[model samples]
Target: MTSAEPGAEPLALSGVLTAAEADDTARAIAGEQRADGAIPWFAGHHLDPWDHVEAAMALDTAGRHEQAAAAYDWLARHQNPDGSWYAAYAEGDATRPTDLGRESNFCAYPAVGVLHHYLATGDEAFRRRMWPVVHAAVEFTLGLQQEGGQLGWRRDPDGTPVTDALLTGSSSVYQSLRCALALADLAATPQPDWELALGRLGHAVRHHPERFLDKSRYSMDWYYPVLGGVLRGSAARARLAGGWDDFVIPDLGVRCVRTNPWVTGGESAELALALWTMGLERRAVEVLRSIGHLRAEGGLYWTGYVYADEAVWPAELTTWTAGSLLLAVAALTGDTATRAVFGGAGLPRGLEADCCA
Candidate 1:
């Protein structure tokens, strides 16, 4: 994604897109959005809150702000009084699965996403509308936190919330907290509970490895703290370096699950994002070159290659897959304060300390 012809505006980081490519991508995705704005995946794929948000971010990056906003509006409208979204929603021809109850994390990421949109668009009305929902979601996570300040993973309809904080899940929560506080700040709302909770969660991430339940060897657990700005400098260095061997796959790309026979486009793109965050410019560049592996039939990306690269599995090119690539590219190319944080090299003023705990 760097300049080979020298200069070229760093290629948009979501990889290069012409006005045509951007439009086509947006139109295709926008076509999937239901009248109520629950954007489905591809055509028949079910709507998922996580994937919906991810897709909306991609739409935003693609200059499809209206469509992206519509997607966010859908989330805000459907959020429960408790600040949570349905664990899973019916999508397209798909109905909600009986197996899942409302998930604790289902709402966490989208609230943060709305705030990100607010940052880019400077939409006060949107921010104001998004704040209480963000507060509720953060409040929901608080109820699930153990005395040790770690979060639970899931919630059941009729029972206690699952009490294990996943490493990546918690990392996401850590990110959502900062985003929530930022939304509160933008609206001049003083959320002392958010600040206190963010700090406790930060401390837990800083000190307790045992607090997180994800021991599976995944690239996200390795680089997310740094990628999400929860880890920095020596801590960032130590965390990423510690997980190196488990992720990289020589000339191919980063592997997905260790036991699973997969190496993926999104995972590799995310690594590029994390490396750029941690100031690994050269490594990130190499990754940018390596990412051609996961490119898809329509020039989109199939999630990953399975069976030792024999084929691409679960063959779907997702909006969030594209969204991760876009955000990673924004890190590599943009110069905002967020770029500094996501680059994992720095955090904004006073943000590094006494903030997000």
Candidate 2:
């Protein structure tokens, strides 16, 4: 499949991606999956639980259902007894826990992928099979939430919780919690406690600036709340616009950080998804077009480009980067499951805090 020309016509809302490109990208991602089912950042690199799930979701988007299930099964097999996976595992080696810490966001993300897979396949058996995994992971994640509604980032190897909340990480967990609730609904189970946790987490994301660590320079912290469904409508639009000049490199893509000249495929693709979520299809198409420079010959994407140096940096083709692009394209093309997950359709709205009560 030939790559879409950058700055071509605005992508069609129903058929945004060419069939060939989607298939190639899916193949690229699949090639990176190990025999044990882990999709690492790249061959020989370490796999983080969060990025592994991201890649699996992309595989599901690309119509590779069985491969996606295998990815989840790897997570299930490796999950610690307390419902967490270590922060990182060595690529091609499931037995090696490269980082022993268990991150809240990473543990929670599998639910999002599991639910997305269920939506794509309508596999009741798969849904039932993954229910316990999702349940335990959500419980493990919520166990780390502080009173201020933001979740603690991770636990040390010795089981001590690190209580600082991260804006980007917590925003991700917020989305996962929503997906977890959706999964529970599908399974005929309800989680009132998680619903409350979702509400408070949203409140903290929207109103409690002090609750999270200050990482304003990073683009993810700026746009993740919107991408993760914590912010919506005009507020999300304003947030995107507020950082446009600082993070976006016109005709290049979104920068990894405000001060960096590096444009990352994953961040650029995520911003496109966020823009699409806000009904800015034209702008979203443009944002996605700008990232075309990152696509490699095999349909996998390079991690990032250093515009100042005029070279691709890191020199690695990451599974999650390609996955992010596929997911964004899926949303742009109006794929039903992609739309449902990102658009929060049929997902429960949590209770609002009653300040007066």
Candidate 3:
């Protein structure tokens, strides 16, 4: 919580974000929140459920607990009767659903946000209020899980579930399931079914590449398994090293996709968190430092910079990018709640395949 500004100096390996930078970014993100509590990608942009939760988590990191809680309340209010949300909303306007498809990963992310918020504030009432929300969302998400352990990416606008799975999305869902299970444990509600589901999900993520869509060119598909805690130990390290040269640009941050020259703030920050989770703090600090140029004067972050074109391609500031950066910094500074959420501390590991085999 040092009040240092992010200047030219190299960020300290132990504390990559200063209090000023975190506060500024948090305030900037807060500004994007609509009256209804939805945080859009930016003002006038659409809001996706997953990214909305990500930004809310960052608000918690910055000690903006009220705003963070409001964001969750927004989710609670807007949740579909079936425990899902449409893929995207028009600029936080819940009345205008831009995409009717219900994405499993997006639906499940509220659990992560709720757990993080409760951890940060130690508010049992908030946890109690959000419990049913978490339960319903997880149920909806798990309903879409294929027998192979990979989650179906989305349900069609007509409510037909897509059979295809996405590595990155399912990996994210894995983390969400873990968080949901943690919440259940805290509430003294054990979900044996979820623990069983987690095992199959983890087994699929770590062992069944054929079950998911081939998005190996995307950096998320490469790093998400590690970031989501589905991969660990030597396996996680090896997975990261395998993609290091292809996605990581020295001093420029991480590329969004392997073939793209675009280095995005969100992906870079996420990779930093992944590295931190793997106990590679030095590399994590370096990755976080590389994205410093994305920071705007107001502390919001531009979506990406295209090194090949020497331009910011998206020409937009995104709240999720800022959120990711804040979360990464939170992990680096050893913020107990943030660390516990990301590091899987005090969280159930779920059942292993052998347990049910």
Best by TM-score: 3
Count steric clashes of candidate 2: 0
**Distance from true position, residue 332, model 3, in Å?**
0.5
- Collision count for each candidate, in order: 4, 0, 0
For candidate 3, the 10 contiguous residues with the lowest summed lDDT are 2-11
**Which digits, one per residue and each the tens of the lDDT, describe model 3 over residues 1-357?**
222223312212333566666677787888888877889999999999999999999888777788889899999999999999999999988899999999999999888899999988889999999999999999999999998888999999998999899999999998899999999999999999999999999999888899999999999999999999999999999999999999999888999999989999999999999999999989998998888888888989889999998999799999999999988888887777788888986778788664321
Q: Can you write out model 2's per-residue Cα lDDT over 1-357, one digit (the tens) per residue?
A: 112223222223333356676677888888888888899898889999899989988887777788888899998888889999899987746689889999999999998899899988889999998999999999999999998888999999999999999999999998899889999988889899999999888889899889899999999999999999989988998999999999999889999999988999999999999998999988888888888888889889999999999999989999999999888988988777778888886777676673211
| Structure candidate 2, residue pairs in collision | none
Per-candidate TM-score against the hidden true structure: 0.85, 0.94, 0.95
The lDDT for every candidate, in the order shown, is 0.66, 0.87, 0.88
Per-residue error (Å), model 3, residue 353:
2.2
Where model 1 places Cα greater than 4 Å from the true spot, the runs are 1-28, 92-100, 307-309, 335-357
Clashes of 1: 4
Model 2, residue 324: displacement in angstroms? 0.1
Compose the digit string of candidate 1's lDDT tens values, residues 20-58.
444444555566677776776665666667778867765
